[model samples]
Target: MKELSLYLMSLLYITAGVNHFVMPKVYLRIMPPYVPFHKTMVFLSGIAEVLLGVGLLFTLTREWAAWGIILLLIVIFPANVEQLKNKKARGKLPLWVVILRLPLQLVLIWWAWLYT
Candidate 1:
């Protein structure tokens, strides 16, 4: 069960990371206004997610990758918050979905911690 979950988590991050690139404008929209270099941050975060997701596949890097994921989730949290606060960022996404994302971030962080 643990191994299966690990794989799923890796895939989720990998897909999400790829989405950042495939849909750069989507990510750019949610970036907190205060954060500088919006485009650079979006790409760098995508790279980090892909690297960390791959890292989780190996025993030697799993722990570090898990930690990195936790940190990454924390670092990107403001974007989620921005989405909730700024209607334009949320686009046509439902109010409930945007509101739910804040708590979902905590759940994601906790899930990553399990691997650590």
Candidate 2:
């Protein structure tokens, strides 16, 4: 179960990272208007996610990778909040899923902390 969770988490990050480069326009569109340098932010975030994802796959840097992921999660949280707010306004992304993700972040952080 633990291994499965780790694999899924790693895969999720890698997929998201790839998307940041391959489909950056989508990500850019979602960025809150107040943020500056949207394109640059997307590119940098992509690189970070890819590195973190690759690191998580190897035992040598798993702890550091987990820590990185936790930090990344914290850093991107405001965007998540903004996404949820937008979705709420649009009546998209069902309320239950949005609510569920709020606590899931904590769980993911705890999981990362444990790995570290």
lDDT of each: 0.95, 0.81
Q: Find the candidate with the highest TM-score and give its number.
A: 1
RMSD of 1: 0.6
TM-score of 1: 0.98
Misplaced by over 4 Å in model 2 are 87-92
Q: Candidate 1 — which residues are off by over 4 angstroms?
A: none
Q: Model 2, range 2-107, lDDT digits (tens) per residue?
A: 8888888888888899999998876676577688998999898988998898889899999999999999989877666666677633244676776677778898
State the displacement of the C-alpha of residue 86, model 2, in Å, after optimal TM-score superposition. Answer: 2.7
Deviation (Å) of 16 in candidate 1: 0.6
Per-residue CA lDDT of candidate 1, range 23-111, in tens? 99999999998999999999999999999998999999999999999999999999999999999999999999999899999999999
